[model samples]
Target: MPTLSKLVCAALTCLAVQLPAHADNTDGSFQTAPSFSWWSGDKSANNNATGGGGVFGGRSLSVDGLINSAKNLIGLPYRAGGTSPTSGFDCSGFVQYVFKHAANVDLPRTSRDMAQVGQSVSRDNLRPGDMVFFAHTRGGGNRISHVGVYVGEGHFIHSPSTGKTIQINSMDSGYWSSKFVTARRVTD
Candidate 1:
């Protein structure tokens, strides 16, 4: 239920108050923020230090900003048709909100609809901020039933299904890597 600016401020406040002690982040993992715990899965494997390597993962770009904004909403709940941070968000809703609010890009409402736009990219070609899609079924006929914003390395940020909060997941291994239908570079 926290806004991006508010979250940023809160993060800054936490940083100021805890400036003397930096948590040991020696591994390629992050524990995510406390407030974010409510919204994300908070898995160390997903928050690996590599953060999912992407072609444009280096030197933050506008897309990188969008990626960061989505990552900040790590602890929001999933609402069936929700799109805002306060009410929570679904997979597509999460993608829609991030594009609209962060990059000023207007995307379709449904994950399938979104899959239709943008330039198609191979899994090996994905860059930070590209839209990644998944089909719930593994059948060749299955269509895009879910979507997320690619955040680099092999991770993505998405508001998962009911009872699940926004979280990051790996694209190189796991059910996702298998269900991945295709990726699209929605932005330059």
Candidate 2:
């Protein structure tokens, strides 16, 4: 039977030979090229420095990353028309900030306009990274006046009205469920 060292060497030799071309050393030892990354072919690691996907652009958007980004802003106070972390965020501003920062996708500044940008997604089919819109009963019927990033499990993150901080609320909650206007998917 082959010794463990020999088996490992044989495997490495096969891998090195199968991988992309790289400079060969005079010594018969295995040397992995910088490009020879993800031995298991897992692309989920965003920045492994050895060939993980780079964040940015629509092609690289990660739903988990986007949801995490929105969740990180929880507890931030809401300010009317606010657009940045320093200034705090309103509903639409929170959605805009999360998408632009996490996925490099710029969104309209207002919830109503944002509702027009992406393909409509039914509430039953809602997925993480989808933008969930809402309209208050007293204010414009069916007009989207609020926006949040769905974090899955029927929960969404948003910076609600004045004096309220960013928070995660259940879409099934009486207040929010009744207010839900529609959902849109801005990323794949």
Q: What is the TM-score of each candidate against the true structure?
A: 0.70, 0.68
Q: In every candidate, how many clashes are there?
A: 8, 0
Task: List all candidate RMSDs to the true structure.
Answer: 8.7, 17.0
Q: How well is each residue in 20-90 modelled by candidate 1, as lDDT tens digits?
A: 32231332222353223212334442332234332222332365458668877876899999989989899
Tell me model 2's lDDT, rounded to 2 decimals.
0.70
Model 2 alpha-carbon drift over 4 Å, by segment: 1-58, 137-140
- Scored against the true structure, residue 49 in model 2 reaches a CA lDDT of 19
lDDT of each: 0.70, 0.70
Clash number for candidate 1:
8
RMSD of 2: 17.0
